[model samples]
Target: MSMVNQTQVHETRLSDAVNRIAPSGIRRFFDLATSMDNVISLGVGEPDYTTPWNVREASIHSLERGLTAYTANAGLIELRRAISTYLTKRFAIDYNPDNEVVVTVGASEGIDLAIRAIVNPGDEVLIVEPCFVSYAPIVSLTGGVPVPVPTEISNDFMVEPEEIVKRITPKTKAIMLSYPNNPTGAVMSRKKMAEVADLVIEHDLTVISDEIYAELSYDDEHVSVPTFPGMWERTILISGFSKSFAMTGWRIGYLCAPEPYASAMLKIHQYAMMCASTMAQYAALEALENGQEMMDEMITSYRQRRNYFVKSLREAGLSCHTPGGAFYAFPSIKETGLTSEEFAEAFLMEERVAVVPGHVFGVGGEGHVRCSYAASMSQLEEVVERLKRFNAARIGR
Candidate 1:
């Protein structure tokens, strides 16, 4: 035997699933942005604003009172009750706090728990791409195969019901959706949502709706998929305080679903996470209770940014559709004779401007780059100039 010692018999390495998960391509640009000085970054998706004062104050108070004990595995009842009321009043969606809700570390966790709860090994979950980077990998981690359906900018990236139905097979178990979508700020209309709801009902498929950006809508009120007829029983609604309350670091979110599903998600959640941060839960409770004015103010700022930034991209000779929701603007760079990754790298390396390459978000994302308007207006203005200059160098503008 060639040095086959007992210690060498066991190899410490990542599992196949972990190794197969595609790394977030946004991070490379982010690392580059961090290492360079005098660079204006519109790469990361975090809001530039600090958490609203009242929300921060509540968490501080919680700390001062030494309220650091572990909450119920489901989370504090008070927070759950607040969320229950908020959803009912705001979206006309009702869920009993006792059996239908579970607070998660973030909408991210809620999504993971919900998937692991429903998807069996080899089960198929339909996802719309250029979507959130985490959606596919998370599904894979649960031993469920992620099936992506392409959605394009020509149609504004709305998930079509026909495309979904064509992809459905006997192995199909659920559809995962995020709208207003990340990377492209597309928000599905209520009528279109109803159509998808009908498809789900027809297939008897479940929908895991990630409404993390629901409060950031610039047009009509955000619609929840579960609110449609007969869809409630099949939809798992996931949202959180991060976007609206500017509480991204708080890691607080919740999921609402009917019995068994909610109960199932909670079981995974309780064992995996124990509970979300107690102080953050209290902070989220405060956000739900008293942060409306602050949330509205932030949404107003994002709306202004969206209008200005999208207009700038169009005027600069790039094709960009004004997003109806969220803070990102995804514009095609194909006309410049460069792929999304090459464009993003050259744009950063030469102009000292950083943005995320679109392909990182999955299908229908290539030939474009995702820019976050969550940065300050000054940074955004500089970004437009740099992007225009970069485009001119590569292709006649």
Candidate 2:
């Protein structure tokens, strides 16, 4: 006789926070775009160039030397020292390599750790609207409230100190800052950064500054908010090799902060993941040392592409503010009477060109779209022609 089983069973249960998070809206469109034929994709934020030869050679050398074992929790000491030196040389930000820096898997991990380190459940994290898509979901996953403050094309998408000051309440714990910003490509000025630093000091709030695109500034110099007096102690500065060195797949990033907070973040780093890849760390050291020439060349190309793409979009009857930094151009397409998603879809379907809907970035982005100019000049030229044809048809209809 078959007897009924009497054993107790257990099943996997995902955290409610995980359930609440949506897959990246930026990525969702790319996945759909790839299945189509003859698609000219400007949807991705990746650099179209291959990783520089020197950086690739360094990684290869590390692998040949069998430097594949797990690294120390804070990452390779040499890589940390390289990071500290690079930031100091480039941004004039001071950080001690031994105690104050932790190499993360990527800036993405740095964001997670910063939010998790300081936020207690129910605390609020302030974000700027038309922001990178990850910040809100990551805050929510850390059990913190995500408070978005809208910036505008009129102000060039730069946040005002007063807007940040007003967003604070007793529950507000920290602010997430990204400059040479993704999607919008807006940059923070030194004076504005100082104002933000002043506000943070007045309220005694922490800052998670993501400067991954720091090296991509086209027309302006990038500033670190932490350089302002008293802010070094209150800010966790995040940057990585991905954007500057065209090393996205390598996934090497670092965080710099003062004292107990740094220690707290390192604890999370140690437990969750021991370190970033060993070879990648070695390769990042080379990237920090020998990659500046490559970066300067790439930046020069990106600037030309930026100028060309913005002109092309305007010629196509779209209004886009020329971005000050990063590789994306966020253009307003509301005149087409299409929602951002519908506009992106129709653009792709009709012109065989892929650009992301700006709403995917956040709420204030409804009438806009983001296209990366990181592609080759030839591709950019071709995309512009397709857009012009698409616009002609759109206007006729």
Candidate 3:
């Protein structure tokens, strides 16, 4: 075949949805950092701590006992019940584990199930930005329109209800929220969240709330969306042991919703992924039961790192808002007169310091770079020194 004809055939073989979305901006830098020597990465988002020993031992015990068979499609009842109890105690919300929770491969898959269950083709999903890189692409893959409602750093990246109101339309089916958000590490105030809840109730829309970082809230106790009045029926809560328990590789996450939504998502979960790993589920159960002290220690360390990192970024001449949750510091690179991508690439190549370009995170992200403080304190200290040198060179030029 002619080269032109071969190219056309290759293009035609892929789905339109696959072609429409871009690859993850985070992964591109991650791959680059991995290939290079001595790169100090502030790019990836997982916790620096290993899964606690007790949690690992629980999984080892499960495997030793040959408890390797799949649990129910909804996951081990004990884990679900534990999740239910934890939610009640932590967020003052109640969920019936029997019919309302479905464990998935990760919070990533829980997000996929929620969007797939609720969004019909051509329906609009309001996504607050800058968010985790996956949300918009996942919505698009489902043939749903992802409407970006950009939140400003000036507001600490909190999504104002008016921004959401401006984007709503007759076809809007849902809104996606992640507080203690990714990239920016912005957490919403309860008063602000209540305002958003009011909007959701007014519009009669469903909410896909990703609360994976709920336990890592630094300044105040994290608030679950479903805890708000009138929100229980409308919110799908997604969380897991990945961040808090340092079990990213274990792939145990879950979603909770009203029976109708829960059942619909469970049906999808059954067909797409029968169940999360049995051993992982066992480990997660151990985490809920006995991992609190270790998790609390990790949170304390993260809080200290966050304070030091943000302070260093400011002193290095970058304007950074104090992130209320998560471990990222999104600092403006606007003063350097470089786009986020340019700054990130140059910083990586010259200083061996890796950060994600903010524009990849969607609207209102172009002038900043996302730096994760989830690394060791020593690495973070060195990163600040490299950043200072980089900034000085830029000024000199």
Model 3 quality (TM-score): 0.98
lDDT of 1 at 131: 92
Clashing pairs in 3: none
Cα deviation of 294 in candidate 3 (Å)?
1.0
Whose TM-score is greatest here?
A: 3
Cα error, candidate 2, residue 120 (Å): 0.8
lDDT of each: 0.90, 0.88, 0.94
**Candidate 2 lDDT, 169-259, residue by residue in tens:** 9999988889988889999888888888888899989999998999999887788878889998899998898888898898888899996
Q: Which regions of candidate 3 deviate over 4 angstroms? A: 1-8
Q: What lDDT tens digits, residue by residue, belong to model 3 across residues 1-397? A: 9999997898899998987888889999999999999999889989989998999999999999999998999999999999999988888999999999889999999999999999999999999999999999999999999999999999999999999999999999999999999989999999999999999999999999999999999999997899899999999999998999999999889999999999999999999899999999999999999999998898899999999999999889899999999889999999888999999999999999999999999999999999989999899989988988999967542
lDDT of 1 by residue, 1-397 (tens): 4566633543335577877787788888899899998889899888888998888999999999999999999999999999999999999999999989999999989999989999999999999888999989999998999999989887899988889988999999999989999989999988888998888888889899999998899988888888899989999999998888888889999999997899999989988999999999989999999999988888999999999999999877789988989899999988888889988888889999899999999999998999999988888898888878877866677
Model 2 TM-score, 2 decimals? 0.95
Query: TM-score, each model?
Result: 0.96, 0.95, 0.98
